[model samples]
Target: MDLDEAFELVGEFGPRQKRLTAFLVLLQVFVAFQSMLIVLVGAVPEYHLDLEEIPASREVLAKHVRFASNFTSIATEWYLIKHDAYKVSLAASLYFAGLLIGNIMFGPLSDKLGRKPVYLTGIFFDVIFGYVSAFAPNYEIFAISRFFVGITNGGMSLVSFVLTQEYVGKSFWALTGSLTNLTFAVGIAIYALLGYYIREWRFLAFISNSPGLFFFLLSFMLPESPRWLYSQGRTAEAENVLQYIALGNGKERLSVKLKQCIGAVKKDDSESGVLSLVKHPVLRWRTVILMYIWSGRRKSTTAFLIFAGIACIFTMCLPENRGGFFFSPSILALCGKLTVSAAFNIIYIYTSELYPTVVRNAGLGVCSMTCRFGGILAPFVPSLKTLGPSVPFVVFGISGLSAGFLTLLLPETLNKPIAETIEDLQTSTYQMLKNKKVNQLEENS
Candidate 1:
């Protein structure tokens, strides 16, 4: 019996699983907070430069005052006063760049070192850097600190999601994974509320960073993925974790059954890396498709939103600014957000199901890295405004639509057992193709 079979005997969504899943999902709140904090922290506030002190020609004074009034950004608190608003974009891009780097480094590290350690280390550093960002004396320092924060944020978010999925049975994969993202949405709302009340960015930063402390404390209670332990030939530890899980579900007697299953299960000690995704013929195509879909999803979502924002620019006559949330533009924007968010949730769950345990995190990391690349480039998409207002949207829309079409090529994993090894994946692919060929032959006959 495999780990998934054993999980069924114990209880898939038992009390223990719920507890662990909740704790891990809650960690996403801080990830959201740190990620979206830039929306407010990088905001360029409207301000005026005092022209009374400096003597200048009337025309020169007018020009200086006009430029000063337009020159605004949180980074301007330190420097870049003479620079264009791209400084803010650069700072934001650096944070996403850090996320890209973290995903590259920590995804495989979790597979090698274990999920618990990587997650704990990520949260610890996330907290440290969060505080550093709050107290940064200069814009350069703040940007650097935020970059580190992004690195930790990327690792923590990836590990936590993978860790959560690892604990549950395949039947609950979609439910649990999608539900986990809801916290991130809630965190965004909470940040908005905080922004409304707290005028100071530093104070808001401090409050946002405070949640990582709580998460770090709660993380101690999380156990290593039992499936991972079993894969590593650490049957004794795996048994202990399963026993704890069974006990939590009030099925302590199943411990013996779990032990028997664990004994029969073979361990996969093979090492895998990013390249492993493409090493096998079957997995290689799947990996490529997954990467493209990831990139397309991000590009589509970001570009569409930017397009919607441009639409809002022309429709400023709407009452949304007056107080109503049901304006046409607002509703359209919300719908787009909802659609993209649901797509994100589905893709995350889908990617988790597609990869084997040996390289699951790595696969996720690479896919997420591609998604981050989209994010890194998303900021620049708006610059296409120089071409035309609809031009960026057209580009994003085409990418998104193409991605949507290509998704039909992916094999359905609904109610399917998680693939535990590359051999399992290859065998399944072979059998599926053979069956398809047989069906076609029968039709021809």
Candidate 2:
């Protein structure tokens, strides 16, 4: 069949295929929650030991903070480690750095290798490191373990975004994308519940990640992306995977319609290197703009949120202020963090759908990395507690508003067909901008 005829025929099957794809891709939400619980566990603790409780020595307080900074120190029941606040602060930064490195690696890796391997690898990495974290002998080991956890967590992060765009029909992509964040919010809620009961940080770490092992084992049954397979010229393999999806979703045995549907996609023989991302003007813009939005959002949001939480801790601790139980302030700070988490998800889901598939993974990676970079400076926020928590909030609020504006810069994909190739994106985005200009001119006239 001719290209026009092929597109017409494929349109009918695309929606149904997208349904199956949504179920498969949404599994990443579970993975994301499991990966993030450790961060929450590490970060959201009640600062209980009073200065009076420790010997009247600055060195002792510093030692305590350092001990707590170590993952194993967090697990220690006997020693009230005080001085290592800086270490804990640094570990938190490392956790985010680990997440940054993982996000950066997954994009190129997913582009080179197929999605399933990376997804499964992320799960396994989380599982192995998660268990190691539970039993880490010292703060140094625990700090290193958190970095590895970040790497695995990053892989888990991208697969869902990629899968949703690939499998779901264009119409459902935006809302489907948002659902991952909503589910992540639910995970945070679960972590909160777990935190209440599993006060022992080591046990909390173990329980939080235990689900990842199960998910990794379950991933064996998950099918690889047929679109990815087809893109690489593995036609038969793509067809085989698509057929299984059709059958799994209870469609009648693979019809010739299904075969012809995916068979129609053109192969991408262009080099899949870093340069490929910059080779085209449109693709290059998508990568950079998305990266900027991501970076701005993460940096601003994370920095402010971290500072805010530290302020709340100080408020709860000071007798001159509304000094109350330690958990009271920590809980309030945790509640405030919910807002940050919600904003991050909303922006990410919207941004992921903004770019076409040609640059989707690259775009998402840049955004994710941007957020991680923002998180890198998050540790320093505590130093500014004297300026007030609202200061950080103002910064994050601006970043969020800026990112929201950037989202407006993106062409909406609703009702529009998903762009599966570089040519399609170039034409579509060009015409979109052109139409907007024409509308502006017509309005002025």
By lDDT, the best candidate is 1
lDDT of each: 0.74, 0.59
What pairs collide in candidate 1?
A: none
Instruction: Report the Cα lDDT for candidate 1.
Output: 0.74
Give the TM-scores of the predictions, in the order they appear: 0.80, 0.70
User: Residue 189 deviation, candidate 1, in Å?
Assistant: 0.7
lDDT of 1 by residue, 1-445 (tens): 4576678888899999999998888777888899988888777665455555643444444354433333233644543333345778777888999999999888888877788999899999999999998988777788898899889899879988988888988788777787788888888888888888776778889999998999899789888998777766566788788888889989967753333322222435343667677777767887888888788622233344334344444333444465456556467456545655567777888888888776788888988899987876777888987897656655665666566666767777765666666656656655755765787799799
> Model 2: residues >4 Å from true position, as ranges?
1-80, 253-270, 297-343, 354-359, 378-401, 429-445
| Ten contiguous residues minimizing lDDT sum, candidate 2 | 1-10
- Tell me the lDDT of model 2 at 321: 33
Highest TM-score model number: 1
